[model samples]
Target: MKKILVITLAALLSVFFIDRSYSKHNQAVIQKTLINEIKEHRQEPIVTIDFRKLYDFKWDEVYVFTPGTSLKNIEQTLGFTWLDAKSTGIKNRDDMDLIVFVENNQVAQYIMLPRKYGTLQPMAQKGNFMVKTS
Candidate 1:
C-alpha cells in the first residue's frame, strides 16, 4: 500500500511540473512572435500614448525613447541590466515610453511592456499625446 501511494504522489508531482513547463514554453513562444513582429514593423510610424491613465502608477522614472535608440541603451538608461535582453521586445525607435515601477528599490516586472503591449492597443487611445519630432 505504501509503495502504491508513493508512486501516485510521484506521478502527480511529475504531471504538475510538466504542465508548468509547457505553460511557460507557450508564453515564451508568444513573446518571441510578438518581438519578431515588432522587428518586422520597424519602419512603421511611431504609436501615440495617452499619459493621463499612466500617471496612476508610482513610477520611479519615466523615459521617452525616440527613433534610433537601441534596446541595450534603454537598459542602461534605466540604470539596470539585470533583465532579459528580450524583455523590451525589439529596439526602441517605435516611440517607446518606458514607465518604471519600483518596489523596495528593486525593479518590478521589467517584462511588463512586452506582456501588456499587444498591438500597443492598450495605449494609442484618446488623451494628450507626446508627438516625437526628428
Candidate 2:
C-alpha cells in the first residue's frame, strides 16, 4: 500500500518538473501549421521594418507571461490599453521592448515566426495566443 502512495507521489512530482513553457517541438509544429495557413490564405510579408532596431530598443514597456496566457487578462496585466511593441512609437535601441513568451524557462524567439497569428487565427484556436473574445 505504501508503494502505491510512493508511485502516485512520484508521478505528481514529475508533472511539476515537466517543461511548462510551450516546448520548441510544440512551437515548431504550431509555426509550421500557421505558415501553411498563411500560404493558403495568400498572406505575404508586405512591410519590411528594421527588426534589429526594435530588438535592441530599451522597451518602453514589457510584459512576460507563461504559455497559454489568456488574451483577456492582457489589459489587466498592463493596466492600460493593449499595445503591441511593433506599433509603438517609443524607440530606444538598447534592448528588446516587447511582450515575451517564454519556453524552457527562457525567452522563446523565432526570428521569422510572423507575429500575425491573431490575424490568422482570429478565434484563438488551439495553440493560438490571441483571440477576439471575452
Candidate 3:
C-alpha cells in the first residue's frame, strides 16, 4: 500500500510539473508573437526606455512588463493612474496622452504622444512612454 501511494504521488507531481511548464511555454510564445507583431506594425517609432531610472520594477528579463501586471502595479510604479499619465502636460508641447492597449484586463502595450504632434521621444521625456506586457 505504501509503495502504491508513493508511486501515485510521484506520478501526480510529474504531471503537475509538466502542466506548469507547458503553460509557461504557451504564455511565452503568446507574448513573443504579440511583441513581434507590434514591432512590425507599430505606428510610433520604437525606443528603449531606461527602466533603471524609473522605480525598481521586478519582472522577467524577456518581457518589458511582467505578465499579469495590474493597475495597482502601475499606481505603485508611476504614482499615478493611466489617465493621469496621459493628461499630464509637456513643456513647449500640447497635452500628452497615453495610448494604452489592454489584454485580459492587464496592460499589454502603451504609447505616449503629444496631443498635436505624433512624435516619439525617449522614455524619460515628458511625452514619451512605451511598453509591452504579456
Candidate 4:
C-alpha cells in the first residue's frame, strides 16, 4: 500500500509540472505573436506628407493589442480606468496615445519621433507613455 501511495503521489507531481510547463509555453506563444504584430504595425516606417498619413500603417488597424490581458485585468493590474488616446497632430507622425485602464508607471511603452521642427530641442525625442504607478 505504501508503494502504491508513493507512486500515485509521484504521478500527480509529474502531471502538475507538465501542466505548468504547458501553460508557460502557451503564454510565450501569445506574447511572441503580440510583439510581432506590434513591431510590424506600430514600428513601421513612415512615408507620408500629412498628419493623418501615419495612420496608414498596418499597426493602426489594430486599435488595441491586449496581450493575454482583458480590460478588467488591465484596470486591476494598473489600478485605473481606460482614459483616452489620440494622435499628436504632427506631420507624418506615427505617435499614438495609448489610453489604458490603468495608471502610468506600471508599464513602459514609448515611441521615437523625428528631429524635425526642433520639437525635441537639439536631441532625438522619444515619447514614453507608461502606466503611472503611484
Q: Which numbered prediction scores highest in lDDT against the true structure?
A: 1
Per-residue CA lDDT of candidate 3, range 65-113, in tens?
2323444555555433555332322222334433334444444444343
The CA-based lDDT of model 2 is what? Answer: 0.40
Clashes (backbone N, CA, C under 3 Å), per candidate, total 0, 5, 0, 9
Which lDDT values do the candidates have, in the order given?
0.48, 0.40, 0.43, 0.34
**Model 1 Cα lDDT, one tens digit per residue, 21-81:** 7755754554454455455545555434444453343434334443355767766766766
| Residues 34-119 of candidate 4: C-alpha lDDT, one tens digit per residue | 33434444433431112123222122111222323345554454554433212222222343222221113332222322222112
Score candidate 1 by lDDT: 0.48
TM-score of each: 0.39, 0.28, 0.36, 0.35
Q: Between the candidate structures 1 and 3, which one is better when assessed by lDDT?
A: 1
Ranking by lDDT: 1, 3, 2, 4
Candidate 2: give the clashing pairs. 56-94, 56-95, 57-92, 57-93, 59-97
List ranges where model 3 is wrong by over 4 Å: 43-134
Alpha carbon deviation, residue 108, candidate 3 (Å): 16
Better of 1 and 2 by lDDT: 1
Q: Which portions of model 2 show Cα errors greater than 4 Å?
A: 1-8, 17-24, 40-134
For candidate 1, the per-residue lDDT at 46 reads 48
Error in Å for residue 82 of model 2 = 15
